[model samples]
Target: MLEAARTTPTALWNDSSDLSELKQSIAFGGVGATCNPVIAYSTIKKHLDVWRPRIEAIAAANPTWGESQIGWQAVRDMSVEAAALLKPIFDEHNGRNGRLSVQTDPRFHRDAKALADQAVEFHGLADNIVVKIPATKVGIEAIEDATYRGVSINVTVSFSVPQAVQAGEAIERGLVRREAEGHDVSRMGPVVTLMVGRIDDWLKHVVARDKLFVDPSALEWAGVAAIKRAYEVFQARGLRSRVLSAAFRNVLQWSELIGGDLVVSPPFKWQEIINASGYDVVEKINEPVHEHYLEELNRIPDFRKLYEVDGMTIEEFEDFGPTRKTLRQFLEADADLDALVRDILIPAP
Candidate 1:
């Protein structure tokens, strides 16, 4: 476990940030941490006793702002605090690790400049901040612009080989543009996340809804297969951006991608469970997904769209089944955050 945490260039990450957690998980071998708007909302709700007063102060100080503005201010403050705790480690890693990823508003998904502009602002909040832009078409454009402006990016809302590859290519283009202008790209560490579990979840939903006869176990490997193929594509093309595995469901979410230069981030709850399990971490990244499981899983058209390199086009990404599902869920999280702030700003009678 120590070897898995320290030796491998694969950055072990905890998807949540807290004071003790920042120390504990990093000491347990995490070099990076990530937060989406959903996690940010959850963090505020988790510590209402501590943040409620400050939130009230924010509302008072920003009388011109709505719930969305007040809520996002909370996220900004939380992210900066987490980044402070990780700064030393970030310095130690020379920018490869010790990053706190703050996501842009999901509501801005259709607007490239809104996403990129927010990303640049968040990137200014902390030196170690890696901003997450969704993998939608506009997001890809936003990501490239943000990167050219020197924002280290973490691509989110991605679930397939095509999305990962496209995002990676976008980052590469941005890097090259920066280099052309004599900018330093050395300290920038950008990663494209392949949310393995979410893809698996969507496939499972499809299997049950359609009453398809896929082998039960085949569903488990759907995400693993997509990531494995994506990793291969990344390697074969020499893309500078790394592939990150997120949304852990089973141990394979963390276990199977052990050795590759991958970022395996489980949420804080599962991080404790995984750290306690004492599972032997070995090099399994290069190992191919079982051919039988692949064959069974490919029975689903969605799986093929995810598993194949040409599965979806840039134009088609926003409408893809899993993409739509995740975007809806993330947007709902923003709405929930707004409602949370609204209740405090204007107490319900």
Candidate 2:
């Protein structure tokens, strides 16, 4: 893994804001790190000894701020600390790598203006901060809006080829607008995350619900194939936004997407496992998926939505099975974070 980090054009990213984990990933050549609501909540949940006092202090410092505000401030603090670790790499690699992605409030998914407004604030937190905006219908609008305003964005809650393509297009429009207005667009590094593993999970749900005859073992290849398909589309369209492989369920989730100018972000433990495996880091970015797996996966409609570029229309993005599910999950994570902070503010008997 270390050798591949040094040798391959592909970049490794840590899907955590944990300082210790970030340090480990940095040693392994990971240039980027990210935190969404679920990740941020988990970060605090796992480190109560360290974060509990900080949460109490934040609440005390801002008496008027509610639990949500205090909780988000904690997320911001984590992002800033993580971004500090990646600052050197950010300078060395320019803006394409070395970013700390911070997600906006998931409750604002329907409000593009609210999302972009929060994005502006998050971008101000650090030079290397990459704001995450979900790929809802309004989110496409917000992506362009935030890009024009100079916020480097990572499209989240996305799980389809159409979502990736539309996201790239939205980003292109934003960059073009910036170029037209004479704003510097060079330092802005935008990405569209294909939560490949989540898509696989969604397909599994479909299989169980519909009792599909799809080969169960072959289902593992679904995400790899989906990303490959999205990457092919990104290549053909000459998209500036790179497709990122996130939400790791297996080694192939990151390993198969390795190579090219793209990013493969797995959790710290997954990185440990991948490194221990001593997997040869090969350039399989352009490798074709097996025809048999594709045929078997094509049996499921949800898989078709993920595999085909035109599977879901723009109007269908928010309601798409996986998108809806992920958005709800993120929102729940937000609520969970608030509850944690609420406990700190008003401890129960």
Tens digits of per-residue lDDT for model 1 on 170-204?
99999999999999999998999999999999999
The sequence of per-residue lDDT tens digits that candidate 2 reaches over residues 1-349 is: 6777788877888999999999999998899997788999999999999999999999889989999999999998989999999999999988888999999899999899999999999999999999999988999999999999999999999999889899999999999999999898888889999998998899999999999898887789898898888888888889898889999898888767667678888999998998888687787877888889889999998888878889989999999898998988999999999999988878898
Off by over 4 Å in 2: none
Q: RMSD for all candidates, in order, please.
A: 1.1, 0.9
Each candidate's lDDT (Cα)? 0.89, 0.90
**Most TM-score-accurate candidate:** 2
Worst 10 residues of 2 by lDDT: 252-261
Question: CA shift at 249, candidate 1, in angstroms?
Answer: 0.5
Off by over 4 Å in 1: none
lDDT of 2 at 202: 92
